[model samples]
Target: MTHKIAVTSAFGVESVTKKELKNLGVRDPKAIDGSFVFDGTMRDVSRLNVFLRTGDRVHLVLKEFPARSFDELFDGVKSVPFSDYLPTDARIIVNGKSVKSTLYSLSDCQKIIKKAILSRLSEDKRTTYFPESGPTYEVLFSIRNDLVTLSLNTSGKGLHKRGYRDLVGDAPIKETLAAALVALSPIDAERPFVDPFCGSGTLLIEAATAAMHIAPGISRDFDFLHWNFFDKKLYEETIEEAKSGEKKQKLPFAGYDVDPSAIKLALRHAERAGIREYVHLQARDVKDLSHAKSHGCIVTNPPYGERLLTEREALELYKTFGDVCKRLDQWSINVITSAKGFERAFGKKADRNRKLFNANKECRFYQYDRL
Candidate 1:
C-alpha cells in the first residue's frame, strides 16, 4: 500500500533534504514548512530510514483531519485502525504539538489520543488490560490551523544521532547541520577539504562519508525495524544495497583543533564513524591553518563568542582566520558563526551568506570564493 511520508529537517535545510529525497527516487515531492511530503510504499519507508542524510526524522502519515475540539480530535484519532500498525502490548507514546488550534493543551491532546488508541486496541483484541511489554511505538500529533496530522515515527531517535561522537566541544554542530554545510560547500571527491576549527571532526567525517557515498543511517536502528508489519526482507536488502554503494577509497580530508583533547575525541569519533582512514586529525591552532594543496575548500564552524571564547577573543580569532584565508588563494572559505559583525572581523564582506540555526542559536553561514 502506498503511504504518505513526511521527512523533516531544520528550517533552513529544506533544499538539501528535498534534493536528497529526489535523488532517492521521490518524484516531485512537496514541502510545507520544514517537512517534505511524498507518497511511497513500505520499501520506500525502509529506504528513507536508512539513506536519508539531512533529514531529522521520517514519519509515515497515518491520518489527517480537521478537529477544532477535543471530541473531534479523539474521534479522528480513534477512527484510524490502530491494530493495523500497533500491537496490543505495544507501548504507545503520544507526542503532541499545537499551533493556532482550539485544542491548545498539549498534555490533554496526548492523553485523549492515547486513550483513543487504547480503546481501539482493546476493542480489536477483546480485552481491557494490556501488559505493555512489547516494543515501543511513538505517535506524533500536530495541530495547525485546526487541522490535525497523526503520524508514526519511523525514526525513533533523530537522524543526527549517527551513533558516533560520544563527546562534543563547547559549541559543537549537529551531524545533520554538518552534512548540510558540506552539501552547501564546494568540497567534492576531487578537491581537498579541511575544517580548521574542527570540533570532534563532525564536518570532516560528514564530508568524507558524503564523498564516499556512505549513507549516514546505514548502521543505525530505526523505529520501523521493530514494527510487526514492516517488511524485514526489504529492510535487510536496503542495508545490503547501501553497503554496496560505499566508496572504499580514502579522500583528502583533514581536521585540526586547538584543543588536543578535542583532536583525540575527533579521532575516536572518526574511528567510530568508520572513516578513520579517510580523515586526518591533529592538534593545531587556527592561526597555523594551511594546506599544501591549492584550490581546496575550508568549511568550518568557529567559536562565536557565545560559548567557548570571549567576544574580544572571538573577534581576534576571526581576524586571524581571515588573514590565514588570504594566504590560501583560489579556495572557497565557508564559515558558520553567531558572532555579530563577522564580515568586519573577517576583513571583508562575504560573497553570500545564508541564515541557519545551530541548536536554535540564530546564525549566518558566510561563503567566500577565491582570494
Candidate 2:
C-alpha cells in the first residue's frame, strides 16, 4: 500500500535534508516547512528510517482535513481505517497540538481523536474492550488555521539519538545539527577532520559516519518493526542492501577539549559509536590546536553564551583561535556559535554564513575558507 510520508527535520536545514532524500532515489521530493513529504511505499519508509542523517522522524501521514468544530474533528478522524494500520489490541497514544484554530484545547483534541480511533477500530474487531496487548501505535495530530493533519510515527525515537554518547558536557550539540554542519561543508573524506571544542565528540563521530558511508540507523529499532501491515522481510532485505553499501575502514578524524573529563567522555562515546581507535580524542587548549596535514578541515562548536563560558571570555577565545587558525592557510574553518559579534571578534569576515537553531537558541554557522 502507498502511504503519504513525511521526513521531518529541524529548522533551516531543509535543503540539506532534501538533497539526502533525493540521493536515496526519491523523485520530485518536496519540502514543506522543513519536512520532506512524498507518497511512497513501505520500502521507502523502511529505507528512509534506516539512512536519514539529518531527518528528525519518519511519519506516515494518515489524513488531513479542515475541522473547526469538535464534531467535524471526530468525524474526520473516524473516517480513517485505523484497523488497517493498527492491530486489534494495539496500544494507541495520541498527541495533539493546536495553533490558531477554533478548537484550541490540545487535551480535548487528543481525547476526541483517541475516542474516534477506538470507535473506528471497534467496528472491524467486533469488540468493545480492546486488551491493548499488541504493539504500539503513536498518533500525532496538528491543527493550524482550522486544518488538522494526522500522522503516525514510524521512527521510535528522534534520529539524533544515535544510541551513542552515554554522557555529555556542560554544553553539547545535537547529533542532527552536528551532521547538518558537516553536510554543509566541503571536506575530503580521506583528509584530516578536526573539532577543537569537542564537548562529547558528537561532531567528529557524525563526520566519520558521513565520510565512511555509514548508515545512521543501521542498528536502530523502528516503530514499524512491530506493525501488522509492515513487510518484515522487505525491511530485513533493505538493511542487508544498506549493509552492502557501507565503507568500513579506519576514519581520519580528531577531537580535542580543554577539559580532561570531557576528553574521557569523548573517548567512551567514540567507543560506543564504533570509532574508538580510528579517531583521535585528546585534552588540549584551543591555543595548542594544530595539525601537521594541509588541506584539512576544522568543524567545531566553540564555547558561547553563559553555559560554559562568559560572553567576554568567548569573544576572547574566538580572537585567539582566529590568530591560531591563520597559520593553517590551506584549511577550512567552520564555527557554529551564538556568540555576539563573532565575525568582528574573530578579526575576519566569514566567506558565507547560515542561520541555524541549536537548543532553541538562534545561532549562526560561520564558514571561513583558508584554502
What is the clash tally of candidate 2?
0
Top-scoring candidate (lDDT):
1
TM-score of each: 0.98, 0.97
Per-residue C-alpha lDDT of model 2 across residues 149-244, encoded as one tens digit per residue: 999999978888888866767688999899999999877578888999998899998998888788888877888999989979979988898788
Q: lDDT by residue for model 1 over 1-371, one digit each (tens)?
A: 99999999897878998999999999888987579899999999889888888999999999999998888998999999999998888988999799998999999999999999998988897988878898889999999999999999999999999887777766789999999999999988878898999988899999999999888988888889999899799998999999999886778889999999889889999998899987779999999988888789999999999788899999999999999988897899999999987899989899999999998999999999876
Shift of residue 116 alpha carbon in model 2, Å: 0.3
| Top-scoring candidate (TM-score) | 1
Which window of 10 residues has the lowest lDDT sum in candidate 2?
27-36
Off by over 4 Å in 2: none
Clashes of each: 0, 0
